[model samples]
Every structure is written in C-alpha cells, then in structure tokens.
Target: MSSPSTQPFAMGGREFVAMMASLQALQALAIDAMLPALGVMSHDLGVDGSNERQLIIGIFLIASGLGSLFPGALADRFGRRPVLFVCVGGYVLFSLAAALAPTFGALLAMRACAGVLSSGMIVVSSATIRDRFSGDKMARTQSLVSVVFMIVPMAAPTLGLAVLELFGNWRWVFGIMAGLGAAVFVWAWLRLPETLHPEFRQKIDVRAIAGNMRIAFTTRSAIGYVFALALIQGALFGYINSSQQLVAEHFGAGDLFPLVFGAMAIAMAMANLTNSRIVMRFGARRVSHAAVIAYIILGATQLFFASGEDETIWQFIPIMTLNLCVMGFISANFSAIALQPFARIAGAAASLQVFLRMVIGSVLGALIGQAYDGSARPLAVALVAAGVGCLLLVMFSERGKLFRRLHGQVEQA
Candidate 1:
C-alpha cells in the first residue's frame, strides 16, 4: 500500500470538519436524544426493573461496540462513502423499526442493530480525519469536530422532550431520530467525497488484516491510550446512563434535567473549542496529561463531598462540569495519539480503538450506573477510579514520563 496522503479531499478545512462533526454527532444524538424518553418508554414497554430501563441506552452502546469491530476493515476494503451510506440506511431502517417494535425485546433487538450500523459513522469519520491529518494537527481538528459534535448532546434531550411534547408519545422520539438520520444521509450523499486513496485501499485479506490488528494492539502507546480512553469514557458513559435518574430522583429536579445536562455539555463544548486553539502550541500529551490530573482531583473532591443523600444539584453540577470539561481535553488528544502510528491502516486502527473504547467503557459505565442508589456517590466513586486508572495508563504509555510534547521529541516508549 502507498503511504496515506495528508490532503486526500478537495474541501476546505472548516467544511470538512463540519461534515465530519455532523457525521460523528449522529451517535451522540442517537443516545442522548432518547434520555428524556427513557421513563415513558420503560412504562410503555413494560420493563420491570428500574435498572433494566437503562438497557435502552446500554444496549445501543454495546451493540455499537460489537458493530464497530468490522467497519474499519470494511471501509478500508470498500471505501468510506459506500460503507457510510449503507450504515446510515441501516440506522434509519432500524430506528423506524424500533419505533414500531411491539415488545421490549423487539425494541432492544432493533436498537442493537441500529447501534451496529451507527458504528460506520464513528469509524469512517475518524478514518476520514486520519486520512487528512496526523499528530497535533489531527488532535486540533478532532477538537474542532468535537466542538461541533457537542452541540447534539447539549440539545438532544431537550429536543427529545420537545418532540415528545409535540407528539405526546415516546415513539415519536425514534421517528425524530430517523428524520435526522435521513437528513444527514442526504447531506453526506450530496457533498461528501471518498477520502480513501486508491493506493491505500486494502484487499479483504484475513492475514493482512490480522497483521494490521497486531500492529495496532502491540504498539505500546496505542494500546495504552486505547485503554485510557476506554476508562475515561466509562466515567462519561456512567454519567449519561444515570444522569436522568440522578437529577430527577436524587435532586428532585426532573423538569430541570435538560438544563443541567445541557449546561455540562456546554462546558465540554467550550473546553473542546479552547483545546482546538491551544493544542498545537501545548501539544496533545501536555494538555491531556494536565486534564487527566485535573479530572482526578475533581473526581476525588466530588466523591468526598457527594457521599450519601446529602448531595445537592448545586454541588454536583459544578464538579461534574469541570470534570467533563477536562474530559474534552483528554478525549481528542488520546485518540489522536493512539492513531498517530497507523497512517497505513487508519481504518482498522480507528475501528479497534473505538471498539475497545465503546465496549469496555459502555460495559463498565453501565455497571456503575446500575449500582446507583439514589445518590451521586456511586457515580463519583466510579469517576475517581476511572480518572486514576486513566492517569496510570497514560504513564505506562509514556514509559513513566508525562507532559512531554510529541511534536518534536522522540517517544521514550
């Protein structure tokens, strides 16, 4: 295979980032938009356990992870555009099917299928960005994408609530998702170009695919950062899985849920936007390392103060916002660092990276979420553990070193 080109598409930088952000935001929209509807859907679907209601979110995440494992190879083999179109189509179809599902089991099955298809967007968007840039530039670009992508999470629950209010049914939430998917599909179809260069395209060979997988998994930084990303994401997923319950049940602020969630998301978006501007100067490692340390400190503080039923919304909001803001710094940088060595097999590398992050994070997060006891203690404790674990992983990835810029310095590990 030929070396990957740094400028494979003709689009301007801003437009490209917007397009990629929109594609990536699909996953966020799918998950977050359904949050406000979870209660109503649970009652309608006759779900028995309070914890099982979260399966509506957890199932999609797990399915997305399972579905994500193959899209990179498929994108590398067939090309990004075609695979993306097919995936979006499946996402649309299954979303509609989910709305029409007659039983809870059937709805879960459709959601899982939708998640599988949704992996195409996540893998292909990252691979597309990888095809165009590398190093800190890639990190900066991803931060920019995240700035735009965060808009969905900020608005999705509110949007879901609005849709529910307008239609007076939870099923319409899925309909809205289908509508959004269709719109994005049409936009991508009309404007997006294939980013994979012909010389870089790989044949569907098991031996070659295995070799690339080995390269991605064995690289010390790649694997370490992958797990770090997963751990950090686990904390975020735990929050998402329990955000509705935490705010409504614990704080007695059911109506204020969207405002609280949106505020946190806005903080994250602002952090990513700031990161996009400063990442090139400070480097991905330095920024991400500082962020992780901050995350740990914030998590520890929140855990200490938020114990038992005494925690208040005012106490929870600021700490969670700051922690998630730090997450904005960590997520893009860690992903870029992990993908730095795999230009030749970016699709596969991104697939595996996302697969591990989503599967491990979603599962661990779901477990933490299920352990919720009408208090923020479980979430805080889980986040503290996740932050510490992420810091250790970063240390291992850098061979006991931290905060060194990767732009000019030789990697010690």
Candidate 2:
C-alpha cells in the first residue's frame, strides 16, 4: 500500500511536524507546568497529607485515559479538525474553571474535565502523523516530534514557578495554561487541514468502533507492544506524580526543583534527537530492543543506590536520567511497531492504545507514588518492575524474539 505522504499534503513537512508537536506538547504543558504549584495548591485548597496531593496529577491522567476512547471514533466519522476545535475549546474552558476552583475536590473535578478534553489532541495528532508516514518513517517522525515536545517539559515547571512568584497565587498557573491553549487553538485553526480521507471515513456506530478496537488489541505484535508501552508509561508517571516531593524535599532542591527537573529532561530530549538520526539505519526493532535492555540495566543500577538509606542526590540523578533517556528510544519505536497493522483504522488504533497506556499506567504509577517514604526506593522498585514487565510483553509480542527486523516493512491495511 502507498503511504499517505504520496498524496499532496496541505502543509510542508517541517510545518506539519512542528504543528503536530505543538498539539501534543499542550498535554505536557498541562501536566509538567503544574508540578511547581502542587504544594502551594494543596495548601490553598486545604488538602491534607502529602500523599493526597498527588491525586491532582493522578486523577487528571486517569480521566484523560478514560476519555481517550471516543475522540478517534468521532474523528473517524466527522473529520479531525472539528474534534480538534472542540477539544481545544473545552481545554481552555476547563482550565479557566480549574483556576477558579474553590476547594481541592472541586479543583480535581475541573482537572479531570480538562484532561478528558486534552486527550483528543493526542489522539488526533497521532492519527494525523499516521496519515502521513508508516513503519520506520513514522518512528523517525515521532522521534523528531518528541524532540520538540521535550522542550515544554523542560520549561514548564520553571514557567509555573514564575507565575507563582509574580502573582503569588497558584491559580495563575492554570490561567497561563489557558493562555497556551488559546495559542495552540489559533495555530490549529489556521494551519491544520483535515487529514482523514473521504473513503476511509466510517459510520459512527458502536459495533464498528468496538470491532476496530478489537482488531487493534488482538493483533499479536500490537497487543504486546501496547501493553509494554503501558508498563513503561507507569514508570514515567510514577516519577511525575512524586517528583515535587522527591526533588524538593528529599533532595533539598526546593526552589531549584525546576532546574533539576529540566536537567533530567534534557537527557530524554537528546536521546530522541539521536533516535531520530539513527532509527532509519538501525531499524525500529533493533534500536528499541537495545534501549529496553539498557533500561533494565539502568533500573537495576538505580535500585542499588535507592535500596540503601545513604544514597545521595548525585548518585540518584544520573541513573534516573539514563532510565528516562532510554524511554525516548523505546516509546516512539514501540508505538510505530504496534500501529503497523492499522493503516485504515489508525485513529481507532491510536485511541485504544493510548487509552490502555494512560489508564492502566496511571494506576500503577499512583500506587508507586503513594508508596513514597522519604526515599527513592519505591520509585526504583517500580522502575525495575516496569522495565521487566515491558521486556516480557515485548518478547510475547515478538514471539520470544528480540531485535529481529522485517526489512522494508510497511503498515498493513
């Protein structure tokens, strides 16, 4: 089958990549930008206990995952632009609502609503990318997009802190998010044309959506990779959920939490930049498999330092940064591998895969976050468990094979 890039695209390649990255980057902004405000938000909203405050991030993720299932089906029928517009509008509205939330519970409710809307951006953007590229080409494109996406994570906490310092209110952080949403909305409206083809549009029926999802899930390679992605996401979420407490309080970074967090994020971005340059030559399987093995090794190393009470910040930072760097290689390639069977139903496939990864992964991460005990051991343990579990799932997906490649592979219709 011909790749979607064979058709004339409305926009040029560089612009397309930048726009898609910006669409997905909003989610990163929504989450990471709020990191610096967690403690202050909890205090202002009268939230009790360190652990309870984590619910802010956890609830948003779970809601995003749960809400991911529908947008693809809707987009498959209606076209991507409408769904993108509605999702962005809802994101701006709920962000405003969250900024005005009077209680912790109310803030969580608004956050959940905002997360649900934000998920559409992810589903649509992935579907758009899939509409253009396949196999290693898709993987390379995703890596490039991620390289750009990583900038938001590196800067978000610092931006959030700036808002807090200038306004002395955590509410202004959400206000800033709303402003960012508006900018992205304008970009999408002007530049993003409908990528879904007319012939590929399916009727919006429950049975059809279910069948599409089932096909995506039951495909041997896709299922294994999807589950593995979920497991890896669990480890990332675990870090995000408790990063404030871990970096600020345990490591004594305090006001410098953003600097430490950004330093770690730079490693992941550089890994993605490298992956984009090398994946075409090495093949997605070879590159991702090697990265997973490296992940497990890094996890083990972190466990060594974390299992003891005397582990210092210097020891923990390097190993943990390597683990996240490994993720940059694993995630895009694994996703490209998993979605190889769904050329026709790329939207449905992306939606269902994202749903599983977000929902299941968020829960596992929340468990790890709640287990925090003034030490890094819980995160280290979760990291190890996630790496091993992901490796197993990948083996199952590849039928016990590792690092095998199908030369000149392309997505199947």
Candidate 3:
C-alpha cells in the first residue's frame, strides 16, 4: 500500500467524495429500502407480531454496531482497500443469503452477518477521510460526503416500493443490495487507493488492539463528543425504526409513506449542504451546539403536538422536518469533533467511536421503536430526551463550555 503523500489519489475530489458517500450509503440502503417491505416481509416469513418486523431494521443496526469493533483495526493492520473489498464481498454474499432465507429468523441472521460486513465499509470510509484531513477541514469534507450520503435515505424507500410494484416480491430488496455491493466492490477495486500511512500500521496483537480501543474511549477531549454522538444517534435511529409506522399507520399516509419520509430526508440533506458551506467559518462546535439546542426545542414542540390524541400529519411533518434539519447539523459536526484528536491511530479510534455510537443508538432505538402505541408520542418523548441527554454530555465534555472554537481560522461566534 502506498502512502497518500507518495501516491496521490487517482480520483479527483468530487469522485473521492462520491465513492466514500456510496460506501456509507450501502448501509443506509440496507435499512431504508427495507422499510416499505416490513409488512409483506413479516407476512411472507410467518412473523406474527407487527412490532417484531421492526427487528428487521433494528437487528441489522445493532449487529453493525458490534461489528464496528474489528474493521478499523483490520484496516490499520492491512490496508483500506483490501478491508473494503472483503467487506463489500461479504455484504454481497450475506445479502444473497438473506434474499433466499426460508424464515424470518434465518433472514435476520443473514441481516446481522451482512450488517457486520457493512460496518467495515463505514468505518474504513471514515478512517480514510481521517487519514487525509482533520479539524474544520475534515468537518467540511464530511459534510460534503454526507450531502451525497443523504441521497440514499431520501430515495431508498421509493426505490424499494418501485421494486415491489415491479417484481411483486420483497426479497428483491436484498437482491438489489447484493447487486449494488458488487458494483461498489468493482469500483473500489479499480480506483480506491490505500490511505493508511505505513508508519501507523500496527501488528495484529490483542494487547495493542485493546490499548488502541482504550485510548479512543479515554481521550478526554474526544470521548465526550463520542457519547454525545451516541445519544443523538439514538434519536435518529429511533425515528428510522419507527418512521414507517408513524407515517403510514399512525398518521395514515399509507402508500404516500415514501414521499413523506423522503421529504424529511430532503430537509436533512439541505442542512448538511448548508453546513458544508458555513462550517469552516463558524467552526463545528459553534454550529453544532446551536443546532443541538434547537433540536431540543423542536423536539419539545413535536412532543406537544404528538401528545394530543388528535395529532394530525399537518401537526407532525413541519416540526419533525425542523427536528431532522437540526439533526443534519449535529451528526457530521459531532463525528468530526470527536475524531479531531486521533491521527496516528485514526482507524482504531474511528472504529471504537463508531462501535459506541452504533451500539448505544441501536439499543435505544429498538427500545423506543418497541414502545410504539399507534401514535408518535413514544418517538417524540425519545427524541426530546435524546436531545437533552446529548446536550448534557456535550457540556460535560466541554467542562460546561459551549460554542468554543478549536480552529484558529474559524473564530468563536
């Protein structure tokens, strides 16, 4: 593997961002595209409970979280491209297994395995970004990557629905995932270069791995934002797990569920786009701090509306869109901030942080999802509570400080 300094990226900035975004998008597609098929999938697979279908999404995410622990270490030992190929290949195989599963349990098992594989893609992508950039510049690049990343969430359900309409089967979703995985594998094999510095490579030793993981977790400057990211992820995942139910059943959007959900994604994507432009000026901390506070306020307003038994989609969409818009600002900034401290062990640090956030987020999301009672109240409560939890964690991390800029170019606003 050649160092980035010796061998420049074969691709330009736009293609690089696009490839990274596509790697992350595979994970989003695995979840979002399945949302529309949860009902039919449950019925076909003989699942008896409505809430149980939520596991189709929740299990994959939880498993992905657990899987995050290994990829960065492996990428550090090996190289980014090889680890990516392995992940993509495994994802394709598991996706095919899922498409052919005879029962829901088997399908879920396949999903879990596939989730584990896809985590490598996500962690490696982040580590690759970390290898090349840091601080506010990294945040801006991540925001740009996220802008493309948001496209999958915005369109996956609609694409899933189209597949169902065209093919009359839900399993085709997995087939599509497999096809896309293969495509990414080919793309990466052809163009993606190893970004890990040779000097930073560690031998695959248990103690070293443990030590690296510990450093990532114990870093005073980074760990708070890591936990804060987890709290915020809980809210985000809760919405994802419950969104179809909330839109299609609770609010009775029915077939229009995809459109409604896509609209919320658009709100988030726009926020990311705006953040990319302005992040270098205000600094990630200042922008994200303000956004998270706004997130709490929006959550409170959403709760107020959802609390009423008579809450309408009209009451829900606007507040919820605003809530997600703020979320768009929170995630990329938090990730960039949390990752700012690590340079030498970027892969392992990224791995540990991703693991923490994914695990915490998945568990909390599953709990919030299961609390569904034919209304948005449970999700609303979870969102507000997550926002407050994140705020306190951020405060603790910053020693009660907020909006302090670490970058000299970006002044304290």
lDDT of 1 at 144: 97
Q: Sorted on TM-score, highest at the top, how do the candidates line up? A: 2, 3, 1
What are the per-residue Cα lDDT tens digits for candidate 1 across 46-152?
A: 88687788999999998898788899988888888889999999999999999999999999999999999998899999998988888899999999999999999
lDDT of 2 by residue, 1-413 (tens): 32353336689888888888888888888899999989889988888689899999999999999989889888888878899899998999999999999999999999999999999999999888888788888899999999889999999999999999999999999999999899989988987778888777877888988999888888987899999999999999999999999988998888999999998888899999999999999999999999999999999999999988789889988898999999999999998888877878888998998899889988988888899999999999888898999999999998999988887654545
Q: Which portions of model 3 miss their true places by more than 4 Å?
A: 1-6, 408-413
lDDT of each: 0.89, 0.89, 0.90
Is candidate 1 or 3 superior in lDDT?
3
Number of clashes in every candidate structure? 0, 0, 0
Per-candidate Cα RMSD to the true structure, in Å, reads 2.2, 1.4, 2.8
lDDT of each residue in 240-350, candidate 3, tens digit only: 898888889988999999998998898899999999999999999999999999999999998998888799999999998998889989999999888877777778988
Candidate 3: residue 333 lDDT (0-100): 93
